[model samples]
Target: MKQFFLTLAGVFAGLVLFVIVTPIALIALAAAGSSAPATSPNTVLELDLREGLTDQPPTNPFAAFGGAELSVIEVVDALDRAGDDRNVKAVLIRLPEMGMTPAAADEVRQAVRRFRASGKPVIAHSQGFLPVGAVMSSYMVGASASELWMQNTSSFQATGFAADEVFLGDAFGRYGVTADFEQRYEYKNAVNTFTESDFTPAHREAMLSWMRSIYDSALANAAADRRQTPAAMRQAIESGPHSAEQAMALKLVDKIGQVEEAEAEAKRRAGRNAQLVSVADYVSNHGLQPGSGSDAIAIVNAEGAIVTGRDAGGGFGSGSTIYSDDTAAAIYEAIENRAVKAIVIRVSSPGGSPDASEQILAAVRAAKAAGKPVVVSMGTYAASGGYWISSEASAIVAQPSTLTGSIGVFGGKFVLTEALGRFGVDLRGLSVGGEYADAFSPTGRFEGQDRAAFAASIDRTYDQFIARVATGRRLPEARVREIARGRVWTGAQARELGLVDELGGLHEAIARAKALAEIPADRSVRLIRYPTQKSPFEALSEAFGVSAEGAQALVAVGGVLASPEAQGVIARARTEQLRARGASVLADQPVR
Candidate 1:
């Protein structure tokens, strides 16, 4: 009674607060949408990346709670536009100490490269160059500028690249949990974390191969940019933990100075009195208006973990997810729309479900058959199922750091009867239907026949994945298989191996799509965002409905539980729930 009334009152208050907050946000976005870009004489486009970057900016309802983060596309397009603006005399990029993906860094570098082609100077200012713990990606982005200025007090730590994976088999065993799993091939070592104590031979080999390749690629590019030999570059990086003065002495950076000093240098180069323009503000003004042109290039964002059926959102902050039905429907919708001339599938996934990949690939083929040329634009990654869906595109464009490849399959369930028993919970399984009916039961392990069936399924899925790559890439099946053993490759290496046709970004993909469809280079095409953006109201409803129960539970347990660690425990339980329902996909890459 008292509790019921309290809960009811809480719900009502939440609803009212949500209703009140939503409209204010909508009105702000509306005002933002209507506002024109401010003009200034002798503009220097200021790109401060402290806001962070994403492959696709989350819709505002989710984003409003956080600080501003721009999409890679937005950043790149803005720079590209600034290249042609007469008023824009130079560019200033401020690299965040926190870091960004190598692929994103490469994209921004490409944009700067283009802007520099206009004979305008590009300068970079950073507090530090963080190359600690896979910060290689971040380092790659900062070094792209012609002149890099580091703060006098900052440090440079360029330790190069490595892949780290955690093994929980022994840890789980301590708790009496057993992972009953098998892989189709040796390369499919995703289950090793649960079934083995350390990396399998195949997993070790694959990780080493890709890590070395990335390291070498970075070394080569940095050498080329700095006019140093690869050998010298490697020596300099290995000799790191250098102070700003030491970094300058080592020729790693042009100078050690404050941000204001860097800005003064830009103004000096731009003939003085140059105004600074925020790239974000500029891009918003030049952003593509849907249905504005006679012909359209559909940009269908395929970010996050790809899953089957309709979009059932997951991931912390709803930051990542690619629903099979939603993606396929978006592709099909683009195909059906007479106005859309070409399609570009911008993929920034580490892979997901094999079935979901196939479904999305089917839609890509359907669009091609319907006469719309499809191009795949790879972001930070497009591996496993990410590569699966991309395999059938008319062409694939990827940044030099974009991680692709990894065609393999692995699946099974954890047998936790002993673990549960240790917790004073015992379970019994009864199945009268079929031999493999209890195969997925945590109370039991798979028998010989059930194990064989599961292996066969993985084998079949792997074969299908290989076949798609073979057909889409027009490579021999043998070659596809040769590369199919769950191998990851950077875009620079992938192109050499014939995995991607071009080493580029979203703009390159758009250009390729236009070329494939025979659209003239000078002709304008509407970049229509596909899968249709939802209204703020609809997005708010979705956000509230999806997480409302969890949010309420959080409130109810406020007294007993607190802090993010407590929240993390709850989140892990949610992940286990998702796993039990087979929600997470196989190609889901661990965050680098």
Candidate 2:
């Protein structure tokens, strides 16, 4: 009987080994057999922005097993490559109904314009312009294309912008819930959603300022592209919710047709018998990483909230989170590598843990100390802890619509004992060692002393934040403090205030990094991606007998659980933004 048990154990161990080894070996063989992608003459490149946008590439390579949306940076890199390719005759883009932060819209638009500069005709189309749950960002990107086409069933959905908030104060009060929170300054209104029924004067003022700034810039840029004035753009926008025929009449859409019609037009422009090559297929064949081992500029993408420790992507309460330790390691790796000459830190975050922000900030400083020039390319929102890590960069670049700045701190916890009591639940709190042990306990409310202590802590952190910015940006302490009242600023305003170095997108940020690194303007340097992303074999290592087919099935499951559906739910949870433990130094804008 003991011998039989031992034999069973051996068989189990062997099966486990087979499960891990077989799939990896197969993936390795496939990768080894892969060849360079080839482009045929008169081929039209098809780029689809409809797959939705991601600030950066997949943190878990195996996470993209089913299919993937190319990160904004990846899209720009493809355009750069396709622009110079001799066989690529033109480009076709799909800008369907999608959600994009204004900054992302601008960056992709910039890439499309760059492609046009290469004398390649680029056409953009939409299945339904401004469909339900989409944004005007899609239309702005379409406008940047050489020509824009809309479907017959589509309509102009450039509904303009409005800032809104969901106040939970009254709702919580009805249930006897009380929030015990405080901020260092008036502009730090993050906790107000739970404490106030309506926006305070200060909160209303800040939202209007930034929203107006974003809307105006987007309006002006759209008009400029279409050869119209800002006033004309404003007038058209006010008359929005236009039908397909109205869009054509207003010159907002060039042609009204179906997907087939759009493709036929692109093929005609590319010459007879032109074939369409998908961006995904072309990238898969060619790869996105720098092929050469020579001088390179690493693109260190830092998206989502900043937290301490290394990152292991896609887990509960940690979707799209950026771990400072992982970011630091990537920076150090770039610095230590002799092949890398410069680094671009692409940051798109709303700030979370201050300690994590500091960790990333220290790493950026170290890179500069190691003779590696660093540039920060800000995306949709890089306020608070996001701004904290970016303050120390060699220079900062942002799109005109990027929301940045918010140098203040706010922290506390809600007391739900009363609310729970109404629901026939009783709770008690007991603490022995520390005087402030019950400070964060949800069973109790903040006592006067506890509130004061928490406020003081926030004040100290705010001061430290301001001092760091002043030192890094070479501005006076008073000047930094002037802008550090927990106020948000648009990228255009930040640039005007000297908070940002320039107003541009990732492409321009790369140009600035190249210039700072002393790389010649005409020289083409390979873009090195950081941290070396992983693959399917690594992700599904523990699964049994998983073939390529099995891998796809598993990937689909993982993607569904972790992709758009989960992200959308979190995005809509304005009042309860998820963060790591000890996120007291929270820096982020109020829900829009």
Candidate 2 lDDT over 47-116, as tens digits, reads 9877666777765644344344577777777787888888888999988674567888888888888889
On residues 543-588, what C-alpha lDDT tens digit does candidate 1 reach at each position?
5563554543433455233445654564465445445555553442
Candidate 2, which segments miss by more than 4 Å at Cα?
1-33, 65-68, 131-134, 289-293, 312-318, 541-592
Name the regions of candidate 1 deviating beyond 4 angstroms.
2-7, 14-20, 23-27, 30-33, 59-61, 64-68, 267-275, 285-293, 312-318, 544-592
Count the clashes in each prediction.
Answer: 0, 0
lDDT of 2 at 513: 91
lDDT of 1: 0.78
**What TM-score, computed on C-alpha atoms, does each candidate reach?**
0.85, 0.84
Candidate with top lDDT is 2
**TM-score of model 1 vs. true structure:** 0.85
- Global lDDT scores for all candidate models: 0.78, 0.78
Model 2 residue 287 CA deviation (Å) reads 2.1
**Which residue pairs come into collision in candidate 1?**
none
